[model samples]
Target: MSKWTTANIPDQTGRTAVITGANTGLGYETAAALAARGAHVVLAVRNLEKGKAAADLIVGRSPGASVALQELDLTSLASVRSAAGQLRSEYDSIDLLINNAGVMMTPRSTTKDGFELQFGTNHLGHFALTNLLLDRVLAAPGSRIVTVSSTGHRFVRGIRFHDLQWEQQYNRVRAYGQSKLANLMFTYELQRRLHNTQTIAAAAHPGGSKTELTRNLPRPVAALSSLLEPLFQDADMGALPSLRAATDPGVLGGQYFGPDGFGEQRGYPKIVGSTDASHDADAQRRLWAVSEELTSVSSPVI
Candidate 1:
């Protein structure tokens, strides 16, 4: 199959999309492309100023692209819920949702909701948001949910069993890997649950992109990353998998998408195989139950 690119977003006319962390990086690129294709893009970000700035940037680029901003802090369930409520009130149907915001490995820290920063922000938060907006997604046939994961997920040992919250042990990079694993697991289980149903749920990973997601790296390490990053792809190029996963008509639910280059690092978007843990249905089901219990929001039965 041909690789998916920004130019092939199916002229998203009349569609409505929500992309988290859309102020910059792959999220911004994704939003800009969707809006340019005629989707009414909503940038749900943590920083209002950056959100407005991103909107302006998209408008500047797309000229007449319809874009709006909604504040969202993925670490806090309260914040995610509030943002979803606002979106539910403002829009009747949602054609796409990109669970793109994330935090990479960093010093052990807790979010406002007391979960590990990485797992909380990257996995659990998107879990809540997807469930919260389940109605809107189901209401709009052909709607899709695209989650951003990482090739780093293969290194993960899967969700921490006893200390799922990472209270007992904390390793920055491992935690990040676990979170990304959770992303794929979530997508697979969601697709399983929505089986015989409609909304598409898929996961994509951007090839090594020079984005702010690596900002958590300490100064010395960051310098090394900067030196190495240029050898990879740019954020706009990196967003192709996400853009394709979100808009491709041939893109099947539960399919994992990523770059097709060396080791899935840098190339055009194409179907890719995820880790074995990602296909663990029992784990996915357990994670779903835990997520619902933690978020206190069950997915809509429709």
Candidate 2:
């Protein structure tokens, strides 16, 4: 079968999409393609200036694409709450929520909330945001939530429940893996909760792509990004799996999508399998409960 592309995305007219960290790279590409296809795309980002520029670029290319900008810093619960409240007031319903923003292997640091940067920003932030916005999403017809995970999820064995914040010791790669694994677990658990609802939850990954996410990696590993650019796909190509997960009509709840190329790196989007660790039911439930407790946010379903 031929590979799926943005050209296959159905007419997204009348749909409203909220994308996090959409100022550049894969997030920008996903927003641009969706806007071009007639979705009213909201670039939910940490940087408003960059978000506006991204929105302008999408309008420039799509010639009147419906695009808007909203500020969101996932590391801070205050910021997430403020953004969600504002969004809830402004938009009556949200058709798609793309938890696309993330941080990589940065030096050990904590968020404004005092949680580890990666775990806080990548998993906790999205988890809270999705739950806060669940009402709008549930109200919309054919709505979906697509959280972006990564191949890095395979690096960790499982969610370290006792040391979720990496307070014991910091292995940047391992922490990142735990966060990505949480993303998948959250997706599946959400799907289970929404089984009776119209809204569906799915996950996707952009395999080996050249994006600013690598800016936080160690200097040596970061440098390898450019050297491996020939092997790595560009941001637009990398955005395919996400774009597919967000817009594809045939997609089912709990499905995970990724690149179809060698080693699942750099190709068209296809349904893919995650690591055995990512599918742990007990882990998923525990993480969901722990996330709610940590963030002080509750899932709308329960």
Candidate 3:
């Protein structure tokens, strides 16, 4: 397939999009692309400086691009709620919801809510945001919700039902992998739930791109990662699959899109497959229940 770049993006004029973690990495690229195409991009980020800088960067690229920075910390429920409510108040309807922010292998850490950092930020936070924004998303005719997962998810055995928090064994990498897998599972179930509804939900991954998503790693580990750049796709290239997943009118619910390359690592965007474990209905239901319980948020007005 030919390369997919932001310049080639189809027109998204008048559409409003929300992208979590829009400050850097694939998230910034994704938001940049959408904003370039004339979509109003609400960048939901935890850091005010970085978030505003990202929005300004996008606006700089596209002079008339509409970009807003909204404070959001996925690690905290209070933060998420305030941001969600603020977003609702700002825009009557959200045409696109991109759950793009994530955390990685850090020292064994947890969110303010005490859940594993990876699981809380990557999966639960986005899950709650999507559900909370369901009203605006569904309220818009033919809207979509896209959750960004990772190829790293393939490394996890599966999301552990009993120890969802990983309180027992604290291997950061495995925990991160499991959390990403949970993201994919959440995407699957959300699409299932949106069946026959106006909103469509799909999942995508940025092909092994070098980005700030790895900031949590140790200095030594980070230096070792430089070797990955040559082998990994660029962040803009990596953002293409997500852009496609988010903007492709042909995209369907439950579809999984990613780079079509060796080991599913780095290449152009295309629809791909997920592991069987990602298809577990039981686990999805459990996750939904646990997410609502943990976040203490109300069910959205779907």
The model with the greatest lDDT is 2
Regions of candidate 1 where Cα sits further than 4 Å from its true position:
218-224
**Quality of model 3 by C-alpha lDDT:** 0.86
Report residue 36 deviation for candidate 1 (angstroms).
0.7
lDDT tens digits by residue: candidate 2, 1-302: 47899999999999999999999999999999999999999999998998989988999999989998889999999999999999999999999999999999989999999999999999999999999999999999889999999999999999999999999989998999999999999999999999999999999999999888887888777777768778999999999999999988999999999999998889999999998988889989999999999999998896
Best by TM-score, which number? Answer: 2
**Residue pairs in candidate 2 whose N, alpha carbon or C atoms collide under 3 angstroms:** none
Residues 214-242, model 1: lDDT tens digits: 97875776788778776789999899999
> Ten consecutive residues with minimal summed lDDT in candidate 1?
1-10
* Candidate 3: clashing pairs of residues: none
Model 2, runs deviating above 4 Å: 223-226
TM-score of 3: 0.95
lDDT of 3 by residue, 9-74 (tens): 679998999999999989999999899888999899999999888888898998989998999999
Q: Worst 10-residue stretch by lDDT in candidate 3?
A: 1-10
Ranking by lDDT: 2, 1, 3
Tell how far residue 283 is off in model 3, in angstroms: 1.3
The clash count of every prediction, one per candidate, is: 0, 0, 0
